[model samples]
Target: MRNVMILLLGLALCFLAACGANESTQGNNGSGEVEGQDEAEPAQNDLDYPQKPISMIVPFSAGGGTDATARALAAASEPYLGESIGIVNTTGGGGAVGMSEGINSTPDGHTITMVTVELTTLPHLGLAQFTYEDFKPVAQINFDPNVIAVPADSPYETIEDLVKDAKDNPGAIRVSNSGTGSIWHIAAASVEQATGAEFSHVPFEGSAPAITAALGNNVEAVSASPPEILSYVESGDLRPLAVLAEERSDALPDTPTFAELGIDATIVGCPRGIMVPKDTPDEIVEFLEEAFMKGAQEAEFVEYMETNGLGLVVGNAEEFGEVLAESHNFFAELIPQMDLN
Candidate 1:
């Protein structure tokens, strides 16, 4: 009887030891820690993305078309993103300064930049060292077709009349653009290319200033978007001669397009979009694309765009990337021909 009791006690002790070992192993695995050691923290991927507010850098001064677009987009996207998107303008170097800041930001998808058509031309003009390839496109929000406008009292009644004057007086008629390498400037260059005329090109800091200069009669005409001069056109302060688009704009349907006039000037406009660092995770990029796309389709956003005379051109990351590549290639070929380089 004594031998039997001793054997039973030994068996009970073994069972207890097994239970303790099992518990210890489970605790170590669950807490990711060993006995008498600290626990390991979770990995970065385990955390929610956009854990903080996003910063959207606009490489232009306030009140410009790009700034307006950025504000509109940020306002619209904040609801969908569940966080605020702050717009920070770091102007200078014809967008180079802000662009560099955006490009050099941490690639964690928290910082993005509002890119314009200038991304395709600035590098070719020796004004920037980076191109569209340097950033990963997130979404394309708006596109505004360039319009040729003159002061309401100008003698030129039609686009043909303006072209005739330009040809007759080469480098005499002064034409103003937003900046030397801006999309507005490219529009003027396209006009010069198609009509084989030479007009003295003047550069301003932005579209607002360029249009103001034209309204004040400082320049013979202004190459800018219809929206930029909408108030002036409505108030009889400016007369729009032509729209450099393949089709007429809804905002200014009465204005003729360069295509209808047999001019081969197409694709002269500003395309506004968002871009992030190229190394951002695909999942994060996808999330942003979906969120921004939803924001773009929101009714308030559409109304704002229409009211402001800006066209809503929404595209996801892949589509935007394709557009960027095409624009870059087009400029790469056209810049040399226009001697802009």
Candidate 2:
């Protein structure tokens, strides 16, 4: 009986050793197959991928809002991604060029695009060759409320005065918008609808140029976010008439909102988010979302948004997708009403 018990104990010890060896092999190669056995390779880790530098394509000109946001996000995400992110400015066709490039790129997870309000509105207006379905969302970074401003020397002193002028002269008062179907243009249209007015819609490549035209007195008024016109407003070069939001902007609290005047028009501003080609691997999207969420929470990003009149709206991939879906539906309904194409 003693011999039999010793033999059983030895067998138990051998079984334990075999299990240990299997685990050791699995740990070394990340494949659970036992030594000398053949099996499919285990899933890959992100660290093993993107051996080359990544690229972030900004669908607008350099130094514009999209470019700036792209750079900020890249700076924040590079350390976590373990690779350098290259930013390429491919501007034209109201962001269609860069967006097309991003969509066509291999979805292996190295390419992403920084898009804003147009990402939602352009499709409905027949402007976007590719819809939101073409891109996989990563995260949202900022939400900027559109503002209405006029030349400092313009006769209009209030939003009411501007609306009255537009009402008095339909399609006569030239108004500058960032682009067709953009949030800025939507704000402009909202003003026209609320007040039953008409203004000649003048489109520009981006907010910077639109605001620049306003400052240069090339246009009677400009529709852009506070960030694009803050300095001009501060320097007395431009006068902010009102913000197209439910409440006044903290940056321009004294400036009233369209609602204050009994115009039920509330554009609620617009949010900016990050996206990659639709076919990018789910794991890569998660990797990017995690990195960006971490960067967004950093004190620097928060301070930057606060100082720049941009509202920070950070969300994970799933949450961002919901926001995108809602915005997509909202714009799909809104563009037809605006009669923009």
Candidate 3:
């Protein structure tokens, strides 16, 4: 009986030791740090870039203006990047889904997203959980100017004519855009503030569908990127009313700008840029910037811009980041006034 009791005591001691070890390990894991283990992994940025295929996420759906822009940019950048560049479309929640994916991506520089004016407006509108600070800007591709377009047979010939009708009809004039707080939507808002005109706002899935609605005469007007409406304008299905830039578009040289039309605000084109998670290595970001800056000037790229009716305003990472900051600040102020929540 004495020997059995001693054995039981020994077994109890061993069980206590095992339980203590498990509890200690659970505590360490919950704390997310191992004792004496370094969390910061050293990585050099200037190393040979694109050791593998790069992935670019386009937040908008395929066949839209943003997706087209992504394809052209990917094509232009692949040779310089020294790897196959793959475009992944992850669209939902008015582009917030793909943006969330971008913000949560690994910081190895292998993955990034093409961000548009939505980058500025999403957080301001409370549609996005992450803000511009969550990203590290890589490079800016171009500015996609918003152009006002109407059906070819519409009575309104110019921007002034449209504004006159809007003023008289109040909310009778129907205008279509991709979504609330999108660049096109903001352009319409700017027009309203400038002219004190009112119109019924119609939101669509993306610019293509919005342009299609305008083409089908479901909406009186559409505010979309030049590429979205260019083909129809060329085919005489739509009439170009005005370009939102300070200057006219090269694609439509005869068109007038909003500034020329005496609008107080310049809607100008929203710039599209590339961004990675905020914690990405500086070297990887620099590598991508260098590649895109050079690739942006290629003749094929210029042809792509012309073919798509987009303006290429290529800039390096720092300049792009500055532009992004300015846009973020601008939308942060503008959204509140428009009551875009």
Candidate 4:
């Protein structure tokens, strides 16, 4: 009896040790990190979003207008966010690649996309891997109407003169745009449709390069945002033909709208905004919208935009969302009619 009792006690002690070991490792995911949270990542709720420095993805070249606006906004918004906002320039695939990376990121508000009008156009063109349905808009922060221009010393004097040149040349006029399916390209194409211009559509990576091409006389005309080509126009290196908007820009009041020029052209320009991945929690999206909009409205940010001739168009999340959907549907119908598609 004594020997059996002693053996039972030994077994009980071993079982207790096993239980202790299991308890110690209950939440471990191996590598000594807990399953739910780790030392580096403390437990967080929806309200506690952006525990780390946020990354804003600017899907364009660094020195472009988009990049400059993104940097300015980030600097302005950092105070409200209480964390640094880093800008990441992911350029390629006519902006589809960078937007893909932004939309597919960890579905956390930490990674935001500085989405542009391309967000709607790319999916319709079959260039993007994702669709607008994957978007969670923070806000629409900018709206720059398209401006088509030529070198200052070009033979074309007026908007009508440019159209006449196109009609006379029969696709000989090399017109440069930001990309094949870009907003600027659509502007150039719309001009072609309206006036039977038959322009030789040459696409570059971004507006800066497209404008550069026009500056070098590689292309006879270039279509880009007014803010982008403002310096060139002011410097007399380029001359504005027409703006693709209902009204003229404050900066370029002399630049006539397409309607004023008697061209029934499709208005195309980049309206940029902030968006997080679609799966990001609602509270986080709300928080981001409020913070970003407030940042966009900051005096310094507004001054920077106005100084650079960037049109500031701020809207709430819902409004921005409506704009995206409406623009998407418009392009859906419009893309079917275009020859480029």
- Candidate 3 residue-wise lDDT, 30-99, digit = tens: 2433333332222334586667899999987677788888888888777777787899988766677888
- Candidate 2 per-residue lDDT over residues 58-168, each given as its tens digit: 877675566666777777666666678999987766677778888899898787888776777777777777887888989877666778999999999998888888898
Q: Write the per-residue lDDT of candidate 4 for residues 133-165, one digit (tens) a residue.
A: 897888877767788899998998888888888
Clashing pairs in 4: none
Give the candidate order by descending TM-score.
Answer: 4, 2, 1, 3
Instruction: Name the regions of candidate 3 deviating beyond 4 angstroms.
Output: 1-51, 339-341
TM-score of 4: 0.84
Find the candidate with the highest lDDT and give its number: 4
lDDT of each: 0.75, 0.71, 0.74, 0.76
How would you encode candidate 1's per-residue C-alpha lDDT over 1-341 as one tens digit per residue? 22112112222122223322443211233232334322222123432887899999998777777888889888877876777899998777667788888888999989999988888878878889998888999987776778999999999999999999999988888888777787778778888887887888888767777788888999999988878888788999999999877668777889998888888763556767899988888888887876686666555666777788776666667766876776777677777777331
Task: Please state the error at residue 75 of candidate 2 in Å.
Answer: 1.8
True-structure lDDT of candidate 1: 0.75
> Regarding TM-score, does 1 or 2 come out ahead?
2
Give the candidate number with the greatest TM-score: 4
Candidate 3 clash pair list: 45-283
The list of candidate 2 runs beyond 4 A from truth reads 1-47
What shift in Å separates residue 73 of candidate 1 from its native position after superposition? 1.2
**Candidate number that wins on TM-score, 2 or 3:** 2
Which stretches of model 4 miss by more than 4 angstroms? 1-46
Error of 1 at 42 (Å): 23
